[model samples]
Target: MSMNTFPIIRVVTKLLIPYILLFALYVQFHGDYGPGGGFQAGVILAAALTLYGLVFGLEAAKRVAPPKLMQRLMALGVLIYAGTGVATMLMGGNFLDYNHLTHDVWPQVLPSGQHLGIFLVELGVGVTVTAVMTMIFYTFAGRQHIT
Candidate 1:
């Protein structure tokens, strides 16, 4: 069936998208100390974006979530994750070996830098997951410009 130019759907998308996104961000950020962390938040955020595209069509969604920008952001997110690992390796250890990061590579105690690195990597994973899934949904919708 065709879902083109539905006034009701347009109105619904306008009203709901803002709230959904706000909640999604809340979940993404606030989950660190509570139940359901970044991954779950990313899924929810992706779902909200997908729903916007599904109801309003790909073109409208693209105005907000541009495919090219989304692609770049997704790549950047993954780069952040991988960069953390690479940095650790450069510091003289295997992938994601947090121990390699510190004021002194051979320090006796584990530095807080290791914890910070892991947190950054996890944040990158969440960002990539959310943006890439939204991009995929937009591509799947394929700019339905039916009238």
Candidate 2:
């Protein structure tokens, strides 16, 4: 059966996608304080997109987030994660030393900087994972043929 054949599924999926994305963001940002984290958030986000693809068709999913964009996202996420470390080093601290993330601006805010650094790093990981997972799903889905 096609997605269009199921009005209820289409309507429900459309209504739920926003909430899924919102939850993913919450997991990504509130990870330090709660049980969720980058990996979990990334997977959640990818799952939402995968659901979209399943319901809307792979071509539609590709139109929403093209493969090229996914590749770029993967690369960009890694760059952000690595760049954070490089930035710490440039600030005259050891690698991955989040304490130095804001030493110059506000020495008193060292802890805050650490939180910010961790958030950025986690965000990078989440983005990379989301992209990779979605890409994988797309690859497999594209290969399938109805008998």
lDDT of each: 0.76, 0.90
Off by over 4 Å in 2: 103-111, 144-147
Query: TM-scores, in order shown?
Result: 0.72, 0.90
Candidate 1 lDDT, 14-124, residue by residue in tens: 799889888877776666556655677778888887877777666777888888888997998889889989998998889988766675644565346655565667678
- Candidate 1 off by > 4 Å: 1-8, 90-94, 99-115, 143-147
- After TM-score superposition, what is the CA distance of residue 142 in candidate 2 from its true location, in Å? 1.2
Could you tell me which residue pairs clash in candidate 2?
none
Residue 56 lDDT (model 2) = 88
RMSD to native for every prediction?
5.1, 2.4
User: For model 2, how does the per-residue alpha-carbon lDDT over 86-106 read when each residue is reduced to its tens digit?
Assistant: 988998899899988884576
RMSD of 2: 2.4
